[model samples]
Target chain A: MSHDHDHDNELDPFAARVRALETILTQKGLIDPAAIDVIVDTYETKIGPRNGAKVVAKAWVDPDFATWLKRDATAAIGSLGYTGRQGEHMQAVFNAADTHNLVVCTLCSCYPWSVLGLPPVWYKAPPYRSRAVIDPRGVLEEFGLTLPATTKIRVWDSTAELRYLVVPMRPKGTEDWSEERLADLVTRDAMIGTGLARVPA
Target chain B: MNRREANSHAAMLPAGVDAPVFAEPWQATAFAMTVALHDKGLFSWSEWADALSAEVKRPGAASDGHDYYEHWLAALEKLLSAKGVAGKGDVDALAAAWERAAHATPHGKPVLLQNDPSPTEGRGGRIG
Candidate 1:
């Protein structure tokens, strides 16, 4: 669909502005609205954290792949065909018994969209960006996750050139679960280190 | 789109696990426009980042971050202006023209640039 999707009576000013810009660009032959729709469609329904979930799920079951993910995330993720923009460089941070990793972009919302889809609104907001670095443990607590006192919390700041994805530890009872089933437990927040994987009920 | 249609796209995820990347259609449109522009080699991501970082750090920005995409839209416009692809004045005129066209066009009909009440009304539609 074109920018005219804002057919509602109460159109946001930004919506009108964006439509205008698209129309102008289209007139100038600078950009294509169809290409934009394809991109929007891709991010909307095709690429998302579901891709990341599969990566994490495979890592949980395959030690070699997990090692490769640590050794060279871009190549390892590419091996699974999850390669794209904003994820040119990736580093998988594994949550272990004594270490937890959290990601933030202090300057901007530099998320690994190729794997994670678009970053959530809160992820781009000031609170999460600033506090994820300043008060990571408190932030995790606010997310209803309380790590042991001895476990070290490490925060990774993402940039345009490189991004980090947190590989959450598999839930205790999911040892026998299939990769697809394990992926069902990997929420987008889990990959961003804001939440932990869900345990089987 | 309504919440149901928005959430409908997240059918791949289990219950309570999905989050909408964009809160509004305009945000997604703005985002896709930027990516599309970048894909066409209008400007490098680094340049785009510089423009965005400037807007994000603008004085008197909102504290709650509800206006994050507003800044994003501003950055896109600024970047386009800087690249000489479209200037600020041009964007403003085009926006105004679209406002007029949207009002003039009948309901359920696509709002085309030609739908503007006056083709030569703004500096934008000089080609037609």
Candidate 2:
């Protein structure tokens, strides 16, 4: 349902300053930091991975969207109201029965925040960046996502100009489910290619 | 904005851009502070550029363009220190307070801070 759901408050000075600056700016009245905080909180907690989940769900239910996602991800995703910044350029890779897709930004954390919200801290750390390319299977294993031996893994490295979203395969036994219900099954990591969508419960 | 400042920022930022580049709320604040301060005549764009370039070139800093914001923060700190604004001492005191506050804040709650005594307030109190 999420990525590294811990709320560890051991913030760095940079992280703390923005929080401080929020106070500093609120007094200045050029903009309301509180309102911005509401939006940021939504993206961090409520909306974070949910945007990507909706896109995945739509792709599953709408064949046309899936086709478009495969052919032209930028427009298809943008049409869904999930477009901006680091995600200006995008490619959606589907997870097939035999092939699994993974994403990483080795140079820096170029995540689709417009859809995925802020990336987990681990994603930006040195270990994940180096190990993701060196041993993706091991990385997946650490995240507790173990793909079968027959499945092939494809890793996409996100760049400043181009980013990627992973579309996990639809779970079984949910053929009659509503789109909203299906979206609830998509976790942030699923779209990050670190985990699979939830199995029907 | 000064002509030089405007020219530099335009060149640095992408063109025809409709992007939400800030990953977190704080990032947006940090970014806005840069622009707002620049417009307020606190520092010239050229000065900012020099500080940022020096920061990027500083040993042990990541020179890649991905961490541009980190460099942005560094430049802000450098400017703050040199101008006798909120130097490292003031920022550090405030930063430590935030660490404690953030640590105590519950999960799913907004991290808020209260003004506390650490570095004495007012310009030049901590800086000078």
Candidate 3:
């Protein structure tokens, strides 16, 4: 069946390149296989989207927790036992009716993978990364959000050591919602300071 | 190639290699994050797109995924260098350490991508 053939073609080129680099570095006595194994195991199995979701879920149900998360996200996130590479130091910014927040890793694709999983391609793309910090208001408009002129805007540039998450303002009429239900409203962009969680219909 | 044949052929290449399936799930996740932030009044899409296009047009811009990663690594190095986090010697030492680890491990075992979400692989776990 064509399906079988189609699957083989799906092998990741990025994986292939990483493997090839590993082979070369190993042959040259540059890197140890054990370290690569540790990296692979940690990122592939231990940390991912689930971790990110957990943080969002907790914040939705607990206001104090959410406040703490915004003040010091690394501590709040660590309280849930989701600390590791790419998420060692984290921060959360809150976006509200009077203020807007956005995040960009202007340098490299440094992200809170332990919380958000691997960054999306567009996050790693040249467009969002470079423009986010320069003209955030315009970018926000493209996503279908238009803020009032009186609202203050804050843009964060993520670095290798610290990653930022955006705590989107809770959608209206969700006062009695459960954590899981509220979390469902948290989209990946909402976590990254691009959008707000949507209110359920 | 016929439409189906072309799609089949394109499907055979690794993701991001084929224009059709060019975006990996992780890439989509990042894009969604950007979109979400924009939707929440973080930034406009046009501003972000324009900035990214400018970055692409920069002199000696990368042409492929490999080049892109390399560029990213270089940018990281520059940031570290600026911060005095590590001198050239420190970077060399880390690279040496990574090489040692890579070589010591056994072959045959696959190096899985960080965001491969296949169900058969037991990856379809809790979403959050």
Q: Which candidate is the best by TM-score?
A: 1
Off by over 4 Å in 3: A1-20, A24-46, B1-67, B70-128
Kindly indicate the candidate among 1 and 3 with the higher DockQ.
Answer: 1
Which lDDT tens digits does candidate 1 get at residues A84-171?
A: 6632589999999999999988877888888899887667767677788878888777666778999999999987778899999999
Top DockQ hit = 1
Query: Per-residue CA lDDT of candidate 3, range A1-201, in tens?
Result: 012332222324333323333333344454466555554445545666567766887887788998899888888998988774322478887777888888887765667876876665556656566667877877666555567889888988876567888777788898888887777777766777655666677
User: Which TM-score values does chain B get in all models?
Assistant: 0.75, 0.67, 0.38
Model 3 chain A poorest 10 in a row by lDDT: A1-10
- Model 2: runs farther than 4 Å from truth? A1-39, B1-128
lDDT of 1 at A10: 32
lDDT of 1: 0.80
How do these models rank on lDDT, best leading?
1, 2, 3
Query: Interface RMSD computed for candidate 1 is what?
Result: 7.0
Give the DockQ (C-alpha) for candidate 3.
0.04
Q: What is the lDDT of residue A172 in candidate 2?
A: 96
Model 1: how far is A28 from its true place, Å? 3.0
State the lDDT of candidate 2 residue by residue for A118-200, as single tens digits: 66645554556667788888777766667898899999987656788999999999999999999998987789887788887
